[model samples]
Target: MAAETDRPAPEALISAFEPDRLLKQDQSGRRIAILGTIHGKQGILTAERAAFATESPEVLKAFHAAITQVTNLGDNDIYRWYLASSGGTNNVTAAAAAQQPPDLKLNLIWPCTESHIKKYSEQVVRMVTETPEIYHDHVRPYMSAKREEGRLNWVFNILEGRTEQEDVILRDEGHRGGAGVAGEYHYDDAFLMLPDLNWDRKTMGSLHLLALVQRRDIWSLRDLKKKHVPWLKYLRQRLLEGTVKMYPELEKDQLKLYVHYQPTYYHFHIHVVNVMLEAGATQATGKAFGLENIISQLETISGDEEAGMADVSLTYFLGEASELWTNVYGPLKRGEKPQAG
Candidate 1:
């Protein structure tokens, strides 16, 4: 039997969130507000929220559901990796922050700079398109959905808050589903903020994340290129203005805006994160797209049919445990350490 010390109790893994008491909001301002906490065996999967402090509650809810599936939660060690930060990182003093490489210095995607980013992205695009069975099904179904009927629309109604009413630290024009979420887009502007707060609002590891949702249908950066830059411009403006309104403690220079290429969901959402926090460690790397680099590239792009989305090369992680690595490229498996980028 595993020693008691080897695994923390499941209750310790989650802090402010209770799956049953969780509420949902839909069109017309009505809510599916359940108000009670349930616990027992199923509570184990809440680990990722603690691990990826900035991910929206919708994203975290989906992750807990996916990981706990009998097939997905295969290796126990891997499960612990996802549970790395339940206790929080608040105790790390500022002096320790200097010892680590700032997330800005890291190659956000495919950490290796040579040919990995392009090659990895190409492999993903081809596989997700040509051989989708290996895609783990997260690539999204917009390709097969009926866009005419408004099915599979991301921005129409997606940003559901993960925490309870009193736990929210901030909410803005783009914020949806904590208490008030109307089906129609209510904000005249395109920015949103939700501080992904744990039960302990003061937890050191909490991510005061904000998102800039574009007015257009720009899914992930995979669909972005030179022509789609006006959205980037708007994102920059939102980051500047929203930071002041919500996080007066931070400055424009101390914050960063990032987009995850293999974002948990499909939406052209820009992440506004505090620069001092080591939020990047939660994301495996390669998946985190630097918005600054994207804006710079957008400014230089020449508008031509040929110079389109291809201009934005990218890479997403497909670990050996993933169906893509196991079923599609089974022969390549040699039990190497997961690069995680």
Candidate 2:
């Protein structure tokens, strides 16, 4: 446990997101999963917790004494933040051809000044380009497509035989976001809309809009387990039953739902935006994940079986315009030796 570069930092940035602090570590010594999500920042610890969340426990006990005077989450001036793309409500993209991961010496610093690297770019490493491919968010890089017959054949092309209900925004036959019935454990009751809404602008608080679709074609969040915990307990009962049939005054705490580790396309979707925008802020770290921090990392595991979510270890944020991190964390950030995906 000491080896997270010798365990020192966390004096409590919420105890570096507990669940027994997943495995913390990072900065390349690996061990990741500091999962409580929301790394999207505008810093000063998000303006001193929005300036003590409207003050009053005598200014919330001086905001817990200024959050114990922030004990370094790698204090690069409060962990240096930046991400400003406002092309929301309706957008257009394609300026991101920058590719620069060779120098390798980052500690999770994002300077996406004026954004739109498509939902905050963060595919921190992936593989297969020796040919054979498949992906099509209709247009756009759509995570560089590649899959012809096998492997998530587009989740059976949206859960089998299209009846094409005109861009379905919400339907719940029971669970995979709602068309229900997929073996009863790894639900995907379907609630759609992400032919690309990564820069949502249904602007209520800011990041408004939805992206649910789980019908069981497991791919990312390391293909989560414990029988997928009833697809995150049915997206926390649709984020607490805010009755969404196109926002019928929806505001279950401005909705959140999440999951996306290098996801642009590989099926297994769910974004449900707006909790005041920037969930992954133009992405670029281990991609997003927050279904209430993976239902609290599956209510803190039991008998392994993906409930340990691939044994919960972690590390992410590889971007040299990723060809699997220019082929894997640009060769372990240059100490060489990574390749094999």
Clashes of each: 5, 32
For candidate 2, lDDT tens digit of each residue in 1-341? 55886654655554343232343332222123433432332212111111125336775565334321111212122122122222221232233312211211123334422222433564543432211111111111322233332434434544443422343455555532334323435343554443222222233344433444545445555556776666567656654464354565666776666776656445666666555444333343456667677767676777755454554554544355745555444565577865533
Query: Model 1: per-residue lDDT, tens digit, 1-341?
Result: 56877876666645533565434322111123444443444432211111343358887675444331121101111111111112222466656633432211011231233323434343432222222332223233432232343432323433343223233233445433332222332243344554432112222223346463534566667566664455466557656676656556657887777887555445566666656555433344656767878867766777773354444434565433443344444432454432221
The Cα error of candidate 2 at residue 325, in Å, is 2.1
What is residue 66's positional error in candidate 1, in angstroms? 25
* Top TM-score hit: 1
Which segments of model 2 are wrong by more than 4 Å? 1-220, 243-246, 249-258, 263-270, 273-320, 327-336, 339-341
Q: Model 2 residue 231 lDDT?
A: 59
Off by over 4 Å in 1: 1-191, 197-206, 212-216, 279-284, 302-306, 323-341
Candidate 2 global CA lDDT score = 0.44
